[model samples]
Target chain A: MPLPIEIVLFIFLLTTAVVIARLEDLFAAAMLTGIFSLLSAGLFTIMDAVDVAFTEAAVGAGVATVFILCTLSLTAKREYQQPTRILPFIVVGITGAALIYGTLDMPAYGDPDAVPHGHLSAKFIEIEEKAFLSQDKHAAEPAQHGSGEKAVGLPNIVTSILASYRGYDTFGETAVIFTATIGVMLLLRTRRREKKVSPPNRDQMETTS
Target chain B: MQWLGLWHYWAVIILMMIGLYIVIARDNLVKKVMGLSIFQVSVIMFYVSTGKVEGGTAPIIPEGGHDLVYSNPLPHVLMLTAIVVGISTTALALALIVRIQEAYGTVEDDELNAIDGAAL
Candidate 1:
């Protein structure tokens, strides 16, 4: 068989990750990270996920890298060495092993015979025609049993899931962002106050000396 | 290799793991962010690869061919929104990093931690 597309994409992704991991210089690593993101976006496009690829190219490869670079400019580039801690590694290994074992009990990817197909998905597919008709008729009925096909019309399930089905969660997430912004503003404001207050204390110390 | 058919997926997974490792293991803040970007890209690759059908054509509707086998367009649509979200996240993250630098004086986690400890 020809080289599978997944394998090729995998190799590319793995190489990018390894390159980023192995690099010692912080700036070079950040640039490589951006390259990795771009490559991943290409991989996404090939996989037929153009929208995600676009996002990855623009955000992962573009904005995130720029942010990292800006932060690097204000910091030392050298890595600090520390003694290795083994306890966390052991816990991680055990957790990972358990997760892998759990996955073995799950359905294989793209398996048409999987239980998911025979479950609610089958009902959804079978009722899809009726759902469309009901939507056309604009009949008043319980929203829960309806096709949930509104997600398709929205052109984005993730957004629909966030903004509609889980609107409350999205609202909470927005609140969290707002809260964090407020916290930052407060902390920064206090820092300015401290700077102003410190001058008087320094002057007093100098007079006593 | 008995599992050659799934090698591509495995490779993507490995790449993701490597990226994650770098993010976790590196001490340099920039390197950590770079690793995070790599990890995120790996996820994007995984999502995109799932849309591929063995012999399907582009998802675009054909003008004349009645028997055209178009790939599923759902994944592509989802990816577009994902891209937008990713961009938004990246912009926000960069802004945070800029603020962090201004406040902390140094971006190195260890140094920042020491400064914080002294302040406390």
Candidate 2:
């Protein structure tokens, strides 16, 4: 019997995670993390989460990996030696066991009757269903649901909710990005006059730039 | 039935544990950041998995298919914002690591702590 595609992808993902955990070389770990994100994005696509897959592909594989690579250029590529790992390992093992125990009570995958699916999401899906019916009626039938025709006129419900229903939340997220960019600029940028104090460092910086 | 239904959660839990171990055990600050990214991605997986519906396609509504089942859109939207925020957080963290390297000439947690102890 052929294994499911997700099972194959999960195997690849687990392998990458293990390799990243054991590797001492920072650069290779960074590269593998990119592969890890790309694989998860593929998994998301297989799960019918195109919007999520797109965002993960863009942010995880693209921006996060680039950031790690840039940081690597500024730091040493090798990790320092640590004396012991027994405590952290045990701690993580316990936490993992606890999380697994908690998962015993969670709703199963793709369960339409799950609590999250049965309430607000059902309402949204209902709106989409009504919209489809209205479209089928060819102007002879009005939308049965008020929210359907007024759902920001976007066929992509995720986009509509992100930009319309949850507009303020998205605005807050954008503000967070803005703040982070400013913080990065402040942390990394040095004044031109200050650069005169460290001529060799200035030259290295200029060369890298 | 049980294993097939809960496999995704178990897989996610394992990934999360690996990420947590890296964050706690790694000496290099950059590796810690990578671990944190992995942890965040694992959480995204958890939420997206919960949002899945049997026989559902992408959340995009087709032109005239009323019977079509689309996956829940709310989680996808939330995770999109989360992905953007995660990238920004990673960017800022890396910038801090760069500054830490410049100041202490080391990115190892122990070395930085030792340097601080000496100064104190």
User: Which candidate has the highest lDDT of all?
Assistant: 2
Flag regions of model 2 displaced more than 4 Å. A1-3, A81-84, A132-149, A192-209, B1-3
Residue-wise C-alpha lDDT for candidate 2, range B28-75, written one tens digit per residue: 999999999989989999999889888889888777766788888888
Candidate 2 chain A has its poorest 10 consecutive residues by lDDT at A145-154
lDDT of 1 by residue, A126-203 (tens): 333344344344647532365444422232333433465456655665665566556546643554655575788867
TM-score of model 1 vs. true structure: 0.62
lDDT of 1: 0.56
lDDT of 1 at A85: 58
Docking class for candidate 1: acceptable
What TM-score should be assigned to candidate 2?
0.90
Q: How much is the lDDT of residue A170 in candidate 1? A: 56
What lDDT would each prediction earn against the true structure? 0.56, 0.86
Give me the displacement of residue B57 in model 1, in angstroms. 3.3
